[model samples]
Target: MNIKLLSGSVALALTIGVGAVPSGASEKPNVVLMLADNVGYGDIGAYGGGAMRGMPTPVLDQLAAEGLQLTQFLVEPGCTPSRAALMTGRYSVRSGLGTIILGGLPNTLQEEEFTLGEMFKSVGYSTAIVGKWHLGFEEQSWPTRQGFDEYRVGVIETSESTLYRPNMERARIDEATILEAVPHIYESDGQGNLTPVREYTLEYRRQIESDIADAAVNYIARQAAAETPFFLYIGWTHTHYPSLTAPEFTGKSTHRYGDAMMELDHRTGQVLQAIEDAGIEDNTIVLWMSDNGASPDAAPWPDKGGSNGPFRGELGDPTEGSIRTVGMIRWPEKIKPGKTNEMVAIHDILPTLASIVGADLPDDRPYDGVDQSAFLLGQQDMSKREHLLTHVNNKVAALRWRHFRIYPKAYRGSFSNPSQEGLLGVQVEKNGGPDIFNIEMDPREEYSISGDNAWVVAQWLRFVAEYNESLREHPNPPGVTLTDPDFGK
Candidate 1:
């Protein structure tokens, strides 16, 4: 591995409460990253939904109160893309995973790509990923191969795959054939051994998050007893399509989605409680965030219980609501608890965590994420990040710089085909010029202020030009596309 170690001065500067470490505590802190699927900005109480949306997330709301809430945390347009960025600290397009991966698709996280789990392992931390591993289905793409030391109670595909067996039954397919085709809940021993634990049935789907929470809690307990620090990535399946409430949580809220939210909140509390019980609250860093904005295509009418707060657009569009979601981080006494409008993206997590653990990033590849350890530690008044580029299907859809959102290619939700829009929306390519919106004043993005902000467009173009120039030396891998004949090659 091409690695660089941080100097003593740099490492000490990043530590909070420098001289206040407990006698035998490890120098590096344990990191727990909880990622919720298809949750919107307004879905959580801290962002404005919660009780008002008929699902009171007391545990999550309280977690926000005790931590630093991020009002403008950004992600990619879909689950796979967001996860790819979170793992690699680079744009999803660079990894050829700019869109959601399908079951039989060849798009996988390559062995050459260094992941967050590998980074943590490099610094002597035990690493594990519990829950959804959607990067690919190949053995080489498994979590164990990517960087996680253990993978448990998870699926290699999306939650929607739970419906495959029933759908196949409706088509009069044989049970044996259906069983052969559908995926099952799997676990890995981090030694090239992957095993199927159980069938991923719809009934199992209802209790999947609960199962994941239990596994994560167990992992935390075991690691707390060890000398090495740990990194746990929990990919929660909640508020996604086919949202099902566990038997215990049924009718707890107004709708199925709300009931699922209640379950998510409660199960997350279980993991938090485990951390507290293990007596590692002061030394552990926990980050709770959503992978993407809510999906209107998940359900219809009252059952479709998700809001984008004040932003426009939904999950798959290149709009504010599509990419922006809830994000919060807590590290007792180290980070002050408050809300900030400063920008942060999913890709920044790996680099930020690497900085906190005193591990140098690999020098073999270019990284899009800048280290925000100083800003996050309260040493700076503003975030180090000022601009972010959003992509869909490997193409530049929008650019967010400061308060301005510039769209070279715009899209809108299609009423005729909501599901199609949620995957790949209807594009509006010819808009005279780039559309600009001052997100601070117009959060909904109702009117374009491009005519008045010509300078903003100029700045955006310059950034894009520089990025394009860098591609000459290190071109991105082939992006996955349905129409590409050589896809997965």
Candidate 2:
């Protein structure tokens, strides 16, 4: 993996497809994108966990009740790829972030890509990203440089142990040692300057989530009081690996992971309450989603991390559970409260919001996302998005047709251990004997319909062929640097 920065327009070609057209409404709604780091599909009460799991998420449940609950929402298998897709409205492959960034490497996001912040800013909407920013750690790739007007960023590159790798291997990591491994925090002015706000420590890690909620609420108040429309991207870092529960939330749930989940749900309610208190609830479009599927192996405790509900597989797997998670959108009086089984993904948010705000997406590159504003707003009966190409790392793991999914290989990973590789887990071949699944019926992906579903395989192959051709024409290298020739390794 050669880690050279691809020239902006030269590397990423311009090829725009049709997306959703904007409505004639002159008053654009304020946008609040609340992202949960690793919250699972079954973690919230709306999805079924709630008090039964020792964590009652009443806030998230209510949000779902008052909004559109999308059951088939998808995302990338990991953090970097998911964030890249969400920000650019394109696949992580296009931006070279198909994998997670490791250690200290150059930024994952290239300077040329269009981001959500930049798009909202282009439409005269103030933009800010609070909490985790895993795209890049370098100056040019920071959120402030990527189109945000103001941001509070944390954790550039994830640490394996936050201590010397060699020493950590032999050292017994206790509470004190773990606290010493916390990630640093910073505040940006949306310009080129970044000021150090708090150094990484165990104490900071414990209170960081609460602090982020405070900052977001304050920002919302200020923006609303000034009568300014703003785009707030709150990427909550709770429920991720090394899940830490705040003091107030500790022991509130059955387990540590559940405790963290409770805290995150409470904070989400706080943010939503702030919006209501600002008297802008009716004028704000609030979207709550998780970055990826839950991880069963996050904290190493029994039944810790998150649950993908009835879906099989964990975070890194290409199965339904790894890519499928919770997604909800709320706009009082604008979007009717209901539920839809439509297949929406993280990448769709950018284009959908762009269409709603009458902002133009860059026409220079092919985008994997389709605008679903019409479908989401009840203007269209069915979603315009029908196919989803599921990829893990740089490989096209599986492709989903309307109700069926076809995988080129058999995934044999268990709930305790997850694997993304198998004999045929590469790109799909035209005449490959891939495994087929009616995911709509078997959301767990336990049964294969390959022999009975020849048409599904053929359709999946066609979609793969088309996407492969696009890749051949554009030739996008992975954005993340762990695989780079001499970058991190």
Candidate 3:
């Protein structure tokens, strides 16, 4: 095992119990976190969505009704960045992943950082990540080294997908780089070693989601019978560009895009059923969400793709449609079934779970996430998160406080738009008045109140000032990106 220990003073101190768990909760609840790739805000039934023009997502809708639905959950604009934030409970930029991993190059989470998987393992919880482990593709950086006990991962660079070739064409990746991007599956044994399983190609692409879900179901049953709590992360690769639908679900929706989403719903339903069958549904915490908003301009999986519903802009932009996404949690009798208008982000998951498990966060580094256990447990009506900093390529693209958002300047892109070349000379001006919107009232961001609402504008600017001060107190540098030298042929 090649586990790199944390260095310096930060590694010297370890503090637990940052948030008080409710009394009389003895047994640690099992956790199952499901993440969809490139899904839109309105693409699920609970959010008024179906796979086709208005396909019905009965399973998701039922899950929302039985769980708590968060209306304004935010995530990073891209896949790798979002996953990084969710795992580390900090800004992706702090993890050197403010942007997606470039083609032919590998980017990974640092060894020093503590992850959600590690946090669970700290409390003696069995952990497994059954799908995409995009945090890092390198040997030492894989999930096994990061704390997962068992892993079934598909290794792919950010440029590759279920439909790898089409993505290469869209990104204009050279043939050599494209050849280096073959998709392969491997299983890990919670060490630095991995055993190759099979090649993931178009013929078998459609079955990936089902296979992952099946693996999760089996894990759940085994954990339940053994009397040990477990953490299962199902990273479903669906609804992204070149959305692949299983053969059985083909033509099940109005279009190929819808078909893919429908398939996602089906696979999710299977996992939920497994929880029920294992008789751990009430004692388990099930969470559903997406990595980020969907991109309508994704050329590889084009089919009048994705509807951000009323929100404006698309993935890769600072707009609400890019960050705000569908979020739900079902814990049977523990979590009251209802909805919350709270402002939460992917970064909050780690701290929230830490509080629930009565565990402590690492005392050494800066953590951007807050404990939302109180909010989830119904101890409080409001979320602990009050403000969020939205970024694009390490630059603060927008500042969000309460119900308002202030975009520093005009920005545009969705998935592959406004390439790295476009980001080079990009200038976000502060001289001209900023564009502000009361996201609560105008979810679409159609109207700007920056010119009319003086109080709101002043309040937002004040928040930014305070945030800047905090950033200075605990300065953060981006994580390291892998170069050819570090790739280790």
Candidate 4:
């Protein structure tokens, strides 16, 4: 069992022939979904980014080289909403999560729903979530309750805190270089509550990175040894805030962010190598997508840099630059290495993965995500997903169906902060989009189409009506308590 890492191109060719195999080929291919928080579409080598010139992201680059690069990918304009959609394959609004969830926010994702981890676990795959668990800080909605058999990361604020603690949650300081110092850690039941985890500075954070990697590798090897197939979701916590990395990768990328990403790249290689070592590389499908658009001030203090390429927006916007990102799928046995401009959203992954694994998705609950199993497996001529929807910021909503996009004149921020603006530089009037353009040509979304484009205007109104109707279908907000869960009363 040696590393069978294929360049994106070579892997694609090997997988094209795998499409005709009967469904559930080689058992459920191990699923390793790795997401970098707020990473832009152009941050990786395959995306033509220059900042990572010497960063040497062989792992991620190889993934793109051997797999299918989904160019027209979409996500929530912000983290919570996008992650909510990803975890459940339903729009965040449908799940009662509108925007970012602070530590104390009530109404965590309901445990009653079928989570992505749960679905995979149900289908005889071992599921684990390591890294940001932003879904619900409440233990009831925590990874353990949400279907993950094992987890090694902290809750929501866990991400924004610090990246290099022994437990990977607390901050530590070395006597001299602030090098990989491990600090005391705490555990939470997912809610804001907390308890001690480990002693401070006892374990270096760098060791934890290797530990997480080791856990994954061991999981794969164990599954293989036991003659059982498995699913491993390696949610990396790098390329994120407090951008820290293994000392080996420091200065490797030249800049702070580059170094952080460089470590991320190298760590990714380790995980892939483990998968191959387990001899499941060819049958495993590794899905890589960013949780949201690029964040501002990624490094050098007040200045942030995430190469969004030609896209002209950042996180927290409804614009293409904000919601659109890079998505890569590498299944050596099922897909060919090539690029597709299919308009995809994170929601689409649930159905695609579930169907591929022969798992049944619940029909009782609505899945806003489209099942593009055919597209991902390279069996279909194109995509079955014609449109994508977005709802981030406060309460603003949008639609991306066919060539049209619609936004209404009125929508409040989350109930608590009604007057807050949801998006920047864009205005919603009785007349939506004073400026709109084809997403292909106007990725900037800077052109106004309200007065000139008749068809788009009509489409806009139609979408708005549909959205309003959907809103009515949802329970109306409760009186006076805008921030609580009762708003959906």
lDDT of candidate 4 over 135-177, digit per residue (tens): 6656677777788776664434434434344333334345343
Off by over 4 Å in 1: 1-25, 174-177, 298-303, 415-421, 483-489
Q: What lDDT would candidate 2 get against the real structure?
A: 0.75
Candidate 3 lDDT by residue in tens digits, 1-489: 011111210121112222333333336788999999888888987776773464668898889999999988988888888998999888888777777765444456778778989998988888888887677667667788888888875554432454676677689998787667666777875454778787677666777888888898898888888656889999988776566678888888777778888888888999999999999888899999998887765434455467777787667767788888899999888789998888888988987787778666777666767767777877767776767778786667887777888887855432434432122223346676788889879987878887787566675666566556556755556543332255344
Better of 2 and 4 by TM-score: 2
Highest-TM-score candidate? 1
Clashing pairs in 3: 16-360, 50-55, 51-258, 95-479, 96-479, 242-301
Candidate 3 least-lDDT 10 residues? 1-10
Better of 1 and 2 by lDDT: 1
Candidate 2: tens digits of C-alpha lDDT, residues 1-489? 011111221121111212222343336788999988877888888888877788899999999999999998999887788899999988787888887775454447888988999988887888888888888766778888899888775555442223343355457666575445445677875355777766655456678789889999999999996645789999898777556768898888768888889899999999999999999998899999998887775434543658889887767657777788999999887688998888888988887787677777766677787777777777768776777787764778888777887788666643334433221123334465888878768887878777777777777767777777777657786454343387544
* Per-residue accuracy of model 1 over 21-53 as CA lDDT, tens digit each: 342337679999999989999988888989998
lDDT (0-100) at residue 393 of candidate 3? Answer: 61
Against the unseen true structure, what C-alpha lDDT does each candidate score? 0.83, 0.75, 0.74, 0.63
Off by over 4 Å in 4: 1-26, 50-54, 155-158, 163-196, 199-209, 297-303, 403-406, 409-434, 467-489
Return the TM-score for candidate 2, rounded to 2 decimals: 0.87
Better by lDDT, candidate 3 or 1: 1
Question: Lowest-scoring 10 consecutive residues by lDDT in candidate 2?
Answer: 1-10
Query: Please, what is the TM-score per model?
Result: 0.93, 0.87, 0.86, 0.80
